[model samples]
Target: MEEQQKKEDGLLNKEETDTLHVDQILRALNPRGRYQILHILLVLLGIPSAGFQLLSNVFIAKRVPHRCAGPPDGSGWSDIFGDTGNLTIVQGRCKLLLTDNSSVVDSAPCVYGHQYKMPENASVISQFDLVCDMDWLARLSQSMVIAGQGVGVVINTFLSDRFGRKTVLVSTSFCLLGCGLAVAYAPNAIVFVVLKFLIGGFQQGILVSKATLFVELLPVEYRSVQSWLSGCTWGFSMMLFAFIAFCFRLRSLFFQTYENDSFMDESLRWLIANGKMKQAQKVIRRIARMNKRSETTILQQIQEKLVLRKENGAEDSERPHKLVGQESCQRLSLLDVLKVKRLLFNSVCLWFCW
Candidate 1:
C-alpha cells in the first residue's frame, strides 16, 4: 500500500522514460494530476460533438413534441400534444409509437408555453413552428455544438503546433467552460443563435488539442488503444443517454434542455477538473455517497496528487527545452485552404470543359 502511494506521487520528483502501463495512464488521466484536467477537457469537448451526433437521433426519435400535443382537452401524447406528436417516417421522424400514456412533447417554450394556438395547427410530427417555438433555439444549440467542435479542432491544431499540448489544452478548456455557460445565459434568441455557432467552433479547437495530448502521451504500441478508448467512450456515452432516457423517460434526457437553468449544469465535471478542485472533490464525494463506495482512499489519492503537482513545478524548470521555435513551425491557416481551392478550380477549368 505504501509503495503504491509512493508510485502515484513519484512523477514529480523524477522523470522516467519507460513504457506506460494502463495503471500509469489511469494515474495520468483520472486521479488528481493535471492530466486529469487534460482528459476531462478532452471529454467535455466531446459533449458538443456527441451532442451533434446525438441530436439527429433525438429529432428522428421524437418529432416536434408538445406539452399537450393534441389539445388541452386531450391528455397524453395524442391528447395533450396533438396529432403532431405522431411520428412520420416520410419526414425522418422516428417510427416510434408511444404505447405509453405519454408521447414525447415539444418542450420548447414557444410551443409548449403558447397560451393561444391557431385553431387549425398545421405543424406535423416533423414540423415545429420555428417562428414561435423555441425548437429553432434547440436546433441552433445542436448546430453550435457541432460547429464549436469543428472549430475547436482547427484552433487547437494551431495551438498544439504553437504551444505545448498542455497550454493549448488550458486555453481550450477555459473557452469551452466559458462558451458553454455563455450559451446557457444567452439573453434572447439572436444571442443564442450567434453564440451557439461560436461555442461549436471553439469546442472543435479543444478536441484537436486533446487528441494531440492523448496521442503523444501514449506509447506508440498502445496508440491504437487510445483510439479504441475514444471509440469505446463515445459508445459508452450513447449508452449513458439510453440509461437516462430509460430511467427518467425522454423528457428529462435532452442534451441542451434540462430543469437546472444555471451554468453549473453545463459541466459539473469541468468545474472540478480546472482548479476548482475542492468543488470537484465535493461533487465526487457526493457521487461516491450515491454509489455507496468508500471515498477515503479517493480523497487520499487527491491529496497525493496535489502534492506531486507542487513538486512538478520545480521539476519542469530543471529540464532543458525539448521543443522547437514557433517561427519555424508550419501554422496552417484558412487562407491556405482558399489558395488550394483556387488552384484546384483553375486546374479543373483549364483541363476540363464545363
Candidate 2:
C-alpha cells in the first residue's frame, strides 16, 4: 500500500530510472523564473564575447595602402615624391638613380620601409608591414588563435568536469581578461601571436563551460528555446561587433567582463555523474525551496530516478560503479573518450566540422 502511494505521488518505477536528473530539478524549479532568466543571460554571454574576440583581428589587421622604397632625399630624384602625389606604384616606382645619373638602381622588396598613405590609425598589418611576401605570416598569426581554441576545448572539458564548472569558468574568464589586455600592448608579432593564442584558449574555455552550465541547468523542453536565445545573442552581438569595429578601436574596448560574473550554479548533473549524490540533492533542495516545490517529494523523486537508472544499467554503463572518492572521480582523459564508441564517433565528426 505504501509502495502504491509512492507510485501515485509521481515517483519513477524501478524499471524506468535514467541518469539525467536535470529534468526533475527543472520541473521542481520551474523553467521560466527570474532565476532562470538571469541564469540564461549569464551563461549566454560566451557566444557574443567569443564572436568579438575572434573577429577583432579583421579590424586590427585591416590592410593599409603603401608604396615601395624611394631614393635618398639628397638625390636629384627628390622630385619623385612630389610628382606622384598620393599615387602608389608609379611608372618609375622603386627606381633609384646613381649620383652621376649613369646607372639605374632597382629597390629591393621593402628594403627601405614602405611609406604608409594613412598616418593616423594604422593597422598592425601596416605597422608591421605584414604584406607582400610576408602575408603568409599574417595568416599564420590568425590561425594560431583557432588552434589554441581547439586545444582548450579538450582541456576545459576535463577541467570543468573534475574541478567543477564554476572554477573553470572563473579562472578562464580572468585569463581572457589578462591576455586581452596584454594583446593590446603587444610589442611585436611574436608577442601578439602568443597572446592571441591565450585569448582563444581562455575564450573557448569560458564558452564551453558556461554553455554547458546553461544547458544542464534548464529543462529539456526549454533547451530548444534556450538554443534560439543563445543563437540570437550571437547574431545580435555580431552586428554590434561590426558597428563597434567601425566606431571604436578593438584593443581599447573591454568585453571580457561578460565571462567573469557569478550568476551561475554548480551543475547538479555533474555532481550526480561523479557520484556526489549528497551534494546533488542539496543543490536540488535549495532550488526546490527557492521555486516553492515540496523538497521532500523532489528528493524522493531523485532517489527513485537513480534507483530506476540502476535497474536499467544506464548509469553503470556510462561510468564504472566504484566507491566514491578521488579515484572514482579521477580526471577524464582523452583515451577515456576514445574508449567509448559513440563518443569517439561524435568527436571525429566534431573535429571535421571544427
Candidate 3:
C-alpha cells in the first residue's frame, strides 16, 4: 500500500510537469515567424480605416460660408453689398432685413433656405439645410458617433468573451462596412445620424476584438513589440487620413471600409479555452506549416498537454471539499472599487485621462 501511494504521487508530479500552458505551446511553435508576420499585417490593415471612420466627420460636415437666400432664384446668397432696396442683410445669421425706401420695415427669417458658398450639396450642412435653428442637428450627429463608441466597448467586450474573437471581429467588420456605406448615401439627417452611431459601434468592436486576438496569439516576449507596432500604425494612419481627406474629401470614408474585410484566423488560445479541441488542432497544424515547424511533434505535445489538463480538471471537479469563504470571495462588483480608496483614486485618474 505504501509503495502504491508513492507511485501515485510520482505519476501526479510527472503529469503536472508534462502539462503545458497556451503561452508555452505558442513559444514552441515559433512565435515570430511567417505566420505571425502575415497575421499581424492583416490585422494592421483595419487600424487605418478605423482612424478614418473616427475623423471623417471633420471633413464631411465642415461648416461652409453661407447666408440667407434672396429673390433672383431664391437659392442664391442675399445681395448684402448690392443696391437692392427691397431686401437687406440682417446683422445675425438667422434673420433677414426687409426695407421700403431704405427704412427698416421688419426682419424676416430665411424663408427660402440659406445658400452656401461651397459647391452644391458639398456637405451635410448644405445638403440638409442645417443652419441657424437646425444647425444643432449636425453637432448632435457627431456626438452620437462618440456615444456609440463608448457603448460598443462595453458590449463587444462581453460578446467577444462569449462568442469568440473571430466571430465578433468578422461580423463587426461587415456591419461597419454596411453602416458606412449607408451613412454616405443617407437621404436625411436623421438617417445619417443613426447610421453614424452604428458605424462607430462596429468600428469599436473591430478595434477591441482585433487587439484582444492579436495580443492573445503572440508570445509574452512579443507583446511589447505588438504594442509599439500598433501605436505607430495608428499614428501613421491618422496622418494618412489627413492626406486621404485632402485628396478625396468625403469619398475617402466609402473606400476605407473595404480593407477591413480581409481574412483572419481564429485564435488558438480561444479555441482551446472554449473546449474546441478539433478546431484547435487544425489551427495548430496550420501554424506549424506556416512557421515551417514539425507538425507531428507539435501535435503530439499538444495532445498530451490537453489530455493531462482534462484529467486534472476532472479530478478537481470530483473533489467535494470547499475552502471557507471561497464562494463569497469569488465575485467582485463596482462597489468594491469605491470601498477601496486607492482603487477609487486610480479609477478616477484613468477615467479623466481617457
Expressed as tens digits, the lDDT of each residue in 1-354 for candidate 2 is 865565345443322323444466577667676666666767766677777888778877777777665545634333443343333333232332222234433333444556666642357676567667666666776798898888898899889878888778888887888887777666877787888888888878888888888777876787788788887998899988877776665444444334555545678767755556556656766676667677667656666766676687766447443332334346556897789899899989978975
Worst 10 residues of 2 by lDDT: 91-100
Q: Provide C-alpha RMSD values for all models, in order.
A: 15.5, 6.9, 7.1
- The alpha-carbon deviation from the true structure for residue 155 of candidate 2, after best TM-score superposition, in angstroms, is 1.1
Q: How far out, in Å, is residue 342 in model 1?
A: 21
Query: Where in model 3 is the C-alpha error above 4 Å?
Result: 1-18, 72-92, 99-105, 250-256, 300-350
Instruction: State how far residue 240 of model 1 sits from its true place (Å).
Output: 1.4
Q: Give candidate 2's error at residue 145 in angstroms.
A: 0.8
Candidate 2: where are CA atoms >4 Å away? 1-22, 69-105, 109-111, 119-121, 254-259, 275-282, 285-333, 336-341
The TM-score leader among the candidates is 3
List per-prediction Cα lDDT, in the order shown.
Answer: 0.44, 0.67, 0.74
Model 1 residue 312 distance off true place after TM-score fit, in angstroms:
35
